[model samples]
Target: MSFAISSNDVRIEERDGHTYLIASSRDEDGNYNHTELNLDECLGNNEGSFNWSGEGFTGSAENIHLSIEGPEQLPILRAHLRDSEGNTHDRDVNLSERIVNDNGCLVFQ
Candidate 1:
């Protein structure tokens, strides 16, 4: 399993006062996999944290933390994942540029 995630693989989306965090990855063979976390549902708020596990680039995230940073107040998520192969990954997803629009409304404040 060579799955990996970076800032570029993360996205934040807002819809009807709800927020979501999404991460995606593509393998060398062009297989795409994604995980979507509803912030309000999983973490209880817009800027919150949660844990997840999946397949292919499958892994588990623990001690997940989310926060806002910089003058623009962008969302940031920090977590460590252990792949199925037992490889560990530490990632800080700066969600500033990865914010996506949902139904023509996407804002983080």
Candidate 2:
């Protein structure tokens, strides 16, 4: 499929207390730096706009069934983002919480 840059922000889905990361970008090789951006990098210590700082996530999505194993302490999240053409990108993310909250939100540090 052809790759296209998405001008939209990432999306999150919360269901039965579990949170899922969803974006226009798909999770695949050759799409990381090209399409995906980490939570810290996306937030950029409060520089870039993952669009999360203000408006937050804005897209319709479904729960991700894939099991994402995280570190024991201060887990680093590997969130997947999608491109305009639906190519997935994986982003290594760090959330603000010391321990992950119920909904698995990617709040940058």
Instruction: Estimate TM-scores for all models.
Output: 0.39, 0.30
Return the lDDT, model 1, position 54: 14
Each candidate's lDDT (Cα)? Answer: 0.45, 0.32
Judged by whole-model lDDT over C-alpha atoms, candidate 1 comes out at: 0.45
Model 2 clashing-pair count: 10
Candidate 2 lDDT over residue span 1-109, tens digit each: 1112221234444544345444444333423221322332232211221234422222311222222233432233444444455554454443323212222222233
Q: Mind giving the per-residue lDDT tens digits that candidate 1 earns over 36-103?
A: 65654433211222332211111254446656666555567666656456555676655444334322
Candidate 2 lDDT at 46 equals 16
Winning candidate number (TM-score): 1
Clashing pairs in 2: 24-82, 24-83, 25-81, 25-82, 25-83, 26-82, 26-87, 26-88, 26-89, 27-88
Instruction: Please report the TM-score between candidate 2 and the true structure.
Output: 0.30
Off by over 4 Å in 2: 1-51, 54-72, 97-109
